[model samples]
Target: MEKQFSGQNQKKLGLSQFVQAIEASRTLAITTKVTELRRQGKTIIDLGAGEPDFPTPAPVCDAGIQAIRNGKTKYTHNAGILELREKIAAFVNKYGGQYQPEQILVSAGAKQSIFNALLAVCDPDDEVLVISPYWTSYPQQVKMARATPVFLQASERDHYKVTAEQLSKAITPKTKLLMFNSPSNPTGATYTKDELAAIADVVAQHDIYLLSDEIYMQLVYDGLEPVSMAMFPQIRSQLILVNGLSKSHAMTGWRVGYLAAELPIVKAAAKVQSHSTSNITSISQYAAVAAFELAETELQKMRTTFAERRDFVTQRLRSMPGVSLSLPQGAFYVYPNFSQYFGKKYQQKTLNAALDIADFLIDAAGVAVVPGEAFGSNENIRISYANSMENLAIAMDQIEVALKKLQ
Candidate 1:
């Protein structure tokens, strides 16, 4: 009976082999688990996810409401409405780059924008070079495209910024694209203009595209300006810039992200968007337009608050024994080195890997932090400081108490 049922199902329905290939990807699964635990009435203070805790600004919400009342619910264009594309092009041009509306493709979110770029450029057996301690999704997305992910290991010693020499050594004939994320997730490392220029010079020698994920560009701290790869004319032809209102305007639920590239690449990405997810919400596009037009003041307020939070959290981590951290120049995250406690025992239990430490923190301290292993490092942990000051203070105090029991 079992063999007959299996045979019938196997003949009628077949799952794609690629579906099984992605089972081990960690971000979505772990985040969902944490959310479920919280839903079950656990006292969980999640420092794991990378979303801002702020609400979308009132003006942006008002714009979306108005758009809905004015009958803007129907899909306008597959690539995005022309008005939004023009706004995006103008926004990109503000950063010393030339982009037309024809060169923009808006999608559901920055994640989808990245997926479109990778799918458009990658072929089977190609290599996608990613700098480590990167966002956890890069390698997964590369593998989904049937491309191999090559890690150029960056570390806390160098502030987690990959060097030109490192990238040069990693590139080969199979290398088709390099994924670069500044104000990086899990590590909070940002590259300077000079560093980007150096990397761009080497990429110019090879036939490689640079997928620059600049979602965190608006969150830079300490008077630092965010640099885009489009600023370099030498590598302009090979750069695809991805950004969105999800991070910058706290519009995560609204799901408005856009990619800026050459016309050919934009056309390819738009076709992918049309077939997969056609046109981000019409109301959301209006919301994004209002966000880009009128939320500059609110954006600055959010930036100031995040900078203070980053300072407070880094200071608290530094005060802990055997914990070391670099002052993240951008992004609202603190990636602290806790390698010294790996082999130590806490409460009769020996700590071994970062997952052990994460579990300990959650169970004993009531705080949730993502292990660096998920970001290609086992010696550190990422704590997002996007929560309120009071919560952050309490969480850090609890973390300190929990660490003292370790050794």
Candidate 2:
């Protein structure tokens, strides 16, 4: 048999192990399925999206148009255009942090900025501590960097937030970085200043890097302000603050995000970005400057709308039978524990995991949602409230009815 091997018997090529280790985004997969169903004339209430339901601010859009008209559509500095970087520096400094233009690197989006920073800091076999119920991309990005991702589950009883003691115990000699997201994506848990300071003390003591993803910092509710890790001078040098216009200004498609770190780290990330995606779109960079400089009023209005939606969604979820959830402090998501119905059956199918419930909802209720298993928990499902009040109300009604049918 060995002697008879030929071209037809040769093994097929496959993707790299790094690429193979990570799964395709579950959120995007559900969204695509929902789109297909809608195209077939089905009315699907999609709550799987992570983007704001608002339009980009008028001033930011106008700036992009002006940039294009002025022939500003040329290659920019690999770290982004200078004016944008300067604006980013000033903005970060305003929040009680010290940053310079040279310390800022602008990439395609906050996701890219975080990925680039991970690649720049992580080496083979390095370990990244990721908080559970995290953004779907964090662990994937760590894997893409050829590093190991170690998860530490934040206390669900404490609103899915990691504490300083928990973080301190999780550290090992192999730990290279910690991924922290405030107003977290799936859970919408925000850290207070005291909590951040305590965690920052641990990072400082360990001398490890911290990647603070603050994309949702602007959407905090109840007059709560987000505290930056960079605001803590003791750990300032070890912090990489990643933020962008995607969330705050409803410019998700614009692809303008930046990171503030030490100069050397910024340079390293810039090199990585240069070899990958040289620079962000020129028009988007110009538009981002206007977003930072002139869109506060519009951004505030959007935040207010999101707060109202958050309250509405939380109230409805709490009132539903067999559903349990904590009120989100920020961000646009409500992750409800749906394990109460795990043993229930519908139409000869038994619902066991969060994915099963999600699939059942899509098939029977025509409501699309991302399952909690995608975020490292199988007992819950994530519902994004970044939709119209009317659509959300209707979706809640449909969900309640669909759940009641499971007996």
Candidate 3:
């Protein structure tokens, strides 16, 4: 006979097992800790944020206010306001690909667009090939959608960008999708037209869906143009182009993101979003229209500033001893490999991983950085130059002094 379970002997209630599979974002965790330390009167230089330091363009903000004043705050179409979608379609179609308003789904943010894409297509056991060091949310989103994340390391030797040959070898029968990011989060590596063409060929051959996260598309520096996977018309059916005004317009708080896919994919993703978040904020949708139209000049100014900061930060990090990194082609981050310091010690603490190094820098240098382990690389750490040059210079100096003490 089986023994009866009593209420006291039963397991305590907690988050669902499915939800528990996803871990809290290490980037956000570090940022929050730094914020708390700063509030406590600690002098902390934060370099962990992924957002631009610039403010949202005045015209875009004014559009939102105007919309509110006009009472354009009602519920929008579940797929998004038609006007915004049409503009998004036009903007995307300006490139090599073709898109229609009906094929676009505007969501709360690019983050939600990504989640909806995965949830719409992936089944419980499907596998998503994630290129590391990926944005930290990729794996968690895959898990939350009941899919498995398969990592293919984009090694530092290759400038942290995966090759088509590697992609071909990694694909299995279980692989249903690939999460692709250019001007990538941690390494800032962008793919050229030739590189994208090669990868597109592989993706087409495998018949797998490609989710191209181009949130940082307009942030590329050095006049390097990032090739969109959607440009390959042969594989357009397999492409889900994800983008937002967050990074491009410094509208991180606006929560405006969208995806352009084929009609079937758009409908499926919109269904997922409709059941969950419904339409994005109506005011944000209106603001995004102005963002696309009136913010280009201001956006260019922000880009110029980021380019300057990127150059300054990259040069400074390269000059530091035992630090090595490829010059990022785009995005505002410099991911420096600090593995050379791994067996060193400071006081009683042994630095064996990037996390340990991050902790050391925060405590000793009063600088906050996201550890490379969070991006699936143990040999490197990510530093964002999205702050003012004055703060960045001071942070780098503190990091230099802290690193020296490790020996």
Candidate of highest lDDT: 3
Q: What shift in Å separates residue 116 of candidate 3 from its native position after superposition?
A: 0.3
| Local accuracy of candidate 3 as per-residue lDDT tens digits, 219-309 | 8889886457778987888999999999988899999999999999999999999999899999999999999897466778888899999
lDDT of each: 0.87, 0.90, 0.91
Displacement of residue 376 (Cα, Å) in model 1 is 1.2
lDDT of 2 by residue, 274-336 (tens): 999899999999999888888466778888899999999899989998798877999899999
RMSD of each: 2.3, 2.8, 3.0
Q: Comparing candidate 2 with candidate 3, which one achieves the higher lDDT? A: 3
Query: Which parts of model 2 have CA positions greater than 4 angstroms off?
Result: 1-12
Runs off by more than 4 Å, candidate 1: 1-15
lDDT of 1 by residue, 8-108 (tens): 22544555567556646555555776788889998788887788999989999999999999999997799888999999999888886799998999999
Ranking by lDDT: 3, 2, 1
lDDT for model 2: 0.90
> If both were scored by lDDT, which would come out higher, candidate 1 or candidate 2?
2
The residue pairs found clashing in candidate 2 are: none
